[model samples]
Target: MTNLKLTRFAPTPSGFLHLGNVYSFIVTYHLSKKHQAKILLRIDDLDRERVKNRYIEDIFDTLNFLELPYDLGPKNLKDFKSSFSQSERMGQYAKALEILRQSKLLFACDCSRKKVEKMHPKGYYTGFCRNRKLPFDQNETSWRLKADMHQDISFKDLNEGHIVGKLPGILTDFIVRKKDGLPAYQLTSVVDDLYFGVDLVVRGKDLFGSTLAQVFLSEHLGPNAFAQNTFYHHYLLQDPNNQKLSKSAGATSIQFMRKSGKKKEDIYMMIGEWLGVKERIKSLEEFGRYV
Candidate 1:
């Protein structure tokens, strides 16, 4: 017999919810049930600029629409002291930032969008600010974790099998702290997962590139900071041309689909089909049956 584990569907509020997002939620939602596991709705709203209150409510509504009952979050908490909200836990990010800074692995960057354009036409963060010792331009600065030139990380993704990537090449020493004095996604996300003891992160196939950055962050979080967390990067629903859905694209949005006169059943059915759900599932349990 196997022990039950916890899985979570983390969504950022940078944009409106989409079919790809909803399908991923459904897949992860059912998967946790299949294993008799717990599911957490982690609102990755660290990006304060774009988070909208309506979208936040929409997330709760979508979960209810699917009728998937969750265990922990602002929506529900059963004495799980961590009544959750990433935005409320700003201190965690600060501590993680301090750890990285102490290791001398933190670098302040001053390259603005304008600077990147003027310096390197190709635009992959040409390290103009990488070497700059200029005091962080508080108004126009960002921070990057020093990427190991040879560090490679891999994880056994439940749905996709073994996935691999290198830490340095994809996006060199990427931003951990934004110029606005707030932590960026890569740093706080890993920190929150580690601090919350999240061991199963079931998310979109798109974040596979994050393998390097996150694994590296986890590995360096002061030793044994996090347990072995498994990931499931499920197949994403793409367009006819196979371009993965982006928030910027309207076709991916459930709200858009809803506005297009898509019945909620029709929307769920389309999402279910996209996720390879074989039969019509009226509830989360029925959804779990297909998985």
Candidate 2:
């Protein structure tokens, strides 16, 4: 069996790909190359409301424009519809959810976001409904994992070194299954990473809390979970307000840049400048030379 580290650029195709997306992709791509790893381009199209066909096509367009190569993914839209879509993997998610349920690690939650925010002024859920033993009805309530709020979860990040934080302090009682019968990001991502054997996950530091949640899930899942995985949370690209750039915020996107007549080298140069690399780059492939 091959021992090559498996890394993935999992993008949620909810909107057009933006500069932040490019930056994170560059970081992930560079790290994968540095470690001699295989890359998988996984599309996270879980949120049906925001996921768009145009966004999916735009992902391929942007990656092609940057000349990024991956070892796995759909070759075309047809393949994507038939195989790579996350909605097609519901059975896998259901099985994982069943495992969690059987372990008695999950509890039904009926509180709405507004209600939770109102109950906890600071926004940290105090497990108000965890012990209510609410019935699990897809139409009525979401499911939350039984988090050890008092315990701290720590992990070794490749870039940040050792980091520690309390799960309750950093994140609220996270949803494993939405009341609308959808799998939560935390559950799907953990399941997907485990299934795909992804060893290195590179993304923005904003997701550090998310990493903690996933690590928490991995530990609870079993000994085999997280055995092959590690993470690298890189610097985030923020806007003028210092807020992280988001697709929903109408951040400058690759499609907009291309429409503005920006060349591929220009995009590389922007990344180089942000990363403080002295020499400019003409292509995404040349970015490694400067590093």
Candidate 3:
């Protein structure tokens, strides 16, 4: 069957695929199945230091146990695309850098983490390197994309409906590459989606704020950079204590559930109940029908 929609279950195999991951995964699976979409499982093993074999295995194991079939990926480091890791996509990031440079939006600075911590700014990016193009040296220096003053990009979110926020100084001067010769998440993610021709993104609301960063970068991207081709569906996130679950929070671990001999039904049911669709998910086939 030629599935009209294309969705991905991209996860970073850095740590155990936890309850938060499962909730998002199953929701994306439901959306994909509803649209008869081709689901690709891309491993976001960007953090090389943390990406391990066991974690990767657990990702597949969890999906397999839940009967969530994927058409591509779940690939290991060796079986992946040459530059599978986001850190390895330097060339692609460099190309993006050149584009931002041509637009006179590229700048450099040698601000340390300590400096930023001492005087934390409202935005994650402190705008230290927004215009301080001192020099590009391997020994030190980071680059940021110049964000225009009081700029804002408005869009309608599928789930959240209308979202109008000021990205003014927030997005001004973001990083495309890091000092360790690694690409930042925003730059790499945008580049990958554009290059891979991803048409739809079904993810948890956790990534909603991330969409803001992507939208800003998209404004400066070239025509047909694949920026305008995608659609996003940010579903409800799983919150254990009216707060987002974290690794430190014992309830967040899926490994803990598995060890406790939790069945597929247990996990699926929890997801359905939380989404308030428990009555609809009578069976695996019933998921798409109801959603």
Candidate 4:
């Protein structure tokens, strides 16, 4: 494999950082070092309703406490707010949206969650709005890409080599710009990755569908570098009930664990046990060996 130039830990400050977040960070750190790539700490703070100042502070606090370092991005909350926040890149997102609009590949929809659930049992968008001809500037309307399910989407995978697949049903015609006038996650993520020159992406396997969605979006944005980037989707850390850990599960958050007197080593040990690593992991270096 060719040496990658950069990778990133793109965390959203919607809630406190959890053990699962740290596991993905460790994997990114390991791969960055392995490929001699610089790490960029990209904080996704676009969801204004869920984003809180305390949650943003927790990101910097957790990284400092764990001694995880990044070569690029804001050094603290103040720096992030001043420059690195996703809001700072609204213009770039707008440009990409315009490109899609000009390509005639975007449609405006004003469907509510309840209405969508009623349309299909699985709640998958039935492309009801594809021919609705809703105005792009209409209030309470979101812009969605008109997806071609039969089209093959291909991208490089760090572990399994080049892989190809069709866009998943759940992500069919995924929203690019939300009703609230902000670019959605799928749109912002591709723009940011391309903007920051991130050639290596590390995320959880749960996001494999998202990866495909972003790759498909990249193709529509004209010739771009996002599709060429390599991805690594690591296994998730689940609770005893085999449920995926979420920020809403406060007890599993690093902040909660820290308050409970769990040191960084304790957190690492817990993750090691969950990962089924035979060797005890007491530090980032030890954990690196296993990842």
Candidate 5:
């Protein structure tokens, strides 16, 4: 055991809970148990355009249906809206943005998606607006970190130990604050983890690049616990075509399965089969053994 204190189930409410989401929950749940760390149900509902009440409701419903429990965070939709909502932490995000601004490591960008694509055929940001000196308060301008592409970022990996890498090309000069003036995921994620004192992070391997990005962003945010936290990037559950399951892929949604008459045991069995575990998995406890 790593003497961990806390971890979280940070789910986004842009779509219904899918099996992939449940798989993440199961891994988080079991890992928390193994390390004697408390679990916090942190819902990422910042994407206002796609967030829906029903999707938020589905998070609680699915957790209850699967009998997955957490040690902290909102117990229901009302509780989340009243206290745990990310929107409530706007001031904290703004504060961090100001710190980054004062560091002179941020620039205002006014490029649109089409414009970015036109600049780089591969769609990667070419730092087009780095020297444009656009005003941060300008309408439709986003704040981007002036990343040091040559600098190495290193962080502790719970499974693989120390990992070192440079910023991925796709995330070059990544946005810290969106054009809407709201903090972007990379910024808010680091702020929220530090806000809640999370020391152990378990997420899918697909976010490996994001992990590196956040670590680099944290360094510029001054001293923060996020950089010291250990991480575990679990393997993802992919489809037959070798594509990772997504919330947008409605067919894999737990809500759809429940509506179609699937039981919790059936859900566990499906996941176990997907993982290729030899023993049948009928409950969360049984699944923990394989985790």
Candidate 6:
């Protein structure tokens, strides 16, 4: 059988889905449908302190409300907490870390953020702990990937065309695992994408830096781990002040919009206008035709 295209909509349930979130989802959904790719709803509930049940519920509710469908993921809260949660995938992360460790590409560091900043005024870790060989204690130190110095990495973004940059400059020695024994976002996201065979990733443009880092990490893991994947970093929905819409700012959340009796058609029309479509979009199905 031919390998099918796989795309994922990963949302961290730290806050309610805002307009920016909705726009990204619309883009992802439209693009996935365009390619007839399988879609997965991956909830990135890594931030223990901020991730709440209400936010998780908001994700499902908003997706259902907008009729943005997915092919895989937890059907409900029970499945999310049991099988789909990132917290339950520690062993997989550990195995990947072991690979990095066996290759001598992993190191432990206990440097505070302020200290690291003070050490490198230019704001990148220049191997201060690369040779220090810090002890491996989950409670005491963070595991960082030893990035290649002065190496160039680039990828073709659907929107931006060819995007290129040098590593350790764009992505210094980033954390793969936190001090609390939990897998970091960079590590878990890459592992999940690789394991699930995701060939397409659509996220906000602000994560371009993250995309580069992920590409680098994937290269270290093996050939074509993410090298063959297609990425689309779409434009972010910003506020009047030019700030990206954020849940913390309480900026036009979907939950609030729903409470205010705004129907799905209202959002579709808004997105249609944004996309420069002359005609009003009656529903997501109609909008999909335009995209």
Model 2 lDDT per residue over 1-291, tens place: 223478999999988998889888877787888888889889998888888899999999999887877888886677888998998889989988888898999999888878887887786677899889888874679999887566688876775567787664536668899888889999899888887888888878778788888888877775655734667887887654566777877637888889889988888777676666778776777766643
Off by over 4 Å in 2: 1-4, 160-163, 168-170, 239-243, 249-251, 289-291
TM-score of each: 0.84, 0.91, 0.83, 0.98, 0.98, 0.89
Worst 10 residues of 2 by lDDT: 221-230
Q: What is the lDDT of residue 114 in candidate 6?
A: 79
lDDT of each residue in 50-105, candidate 4, tens digit only: 99999999999999999988899999999999999998999999999999999999
lDDT for position 233 in model 2: 84
Compared with the true structure, the alpha-carbon lDDT of candidate 1 equals 0.70
Winner on lDDT between 1 and 3 is 1
Task: Rank the models by TM-score, top first.
Answer: 4, 5, 2, 6, 1, 3
Cα RMSD for candidate 2?
Answer: 2.5
lDDT of each: 0.70, 0.81, 0.65, 0.93, 0.91, 0.81
Task: State in Å the error of residue 68, model 5.
Answer: 0.8
How many pairs collide in each candidate, listed in order? 0, 0, 2, 0, 0, 0
- What tens digits encode model 5's per-residue C-alpha lDDT throughout 1-291? 688999999999999998889999999989998999999999998887999999999999999999999999998999999999999999999999999999899999999989988887777899889998998899999999988567799999988899998887788899999988889999989999999999999999889889999999998888777888999999998766777899889989999999999999999998898888888899998987777
Worst 10-residue lDDT window, candidate 1: 76-85
Which portions of model 5 miss their true places by more than 4 Å? Answer: none
Clashes of 3: 2
- What tens-digit string does per-residue lDDT give for candidate 6 at 1-291? 123489999999999998778878777888887777889999988888899999999999999998878899887888899888887877878888888888999999988777788887776776688889877774569899988657777886765667787664535888898887788899899998987789888988788778888888888775555876788888787665666688986647888888989898887776666566789886767856654
Sort by lDDT, top down from the best: 4, 5, 6, 2, 1, 3
Note each model's CA RMSD in angstroms: 3.6, 2.5, 3.4, 0.9, 1.0, 2.7
Report how far residue 235 has shifted in candidate 6, in Å: 1.0
Question: After best superposition, candidate 2 residue 244: deviation in angstroms?
Answer: 2.4
Error of 2 at 35 (Å): 1.0
Candidate 6 least-lDDT 10 residues = 162-171
Scored by lDDT, model 5 comes in at 0.91
On TM-score, the stronger of 2 and 3 is 2
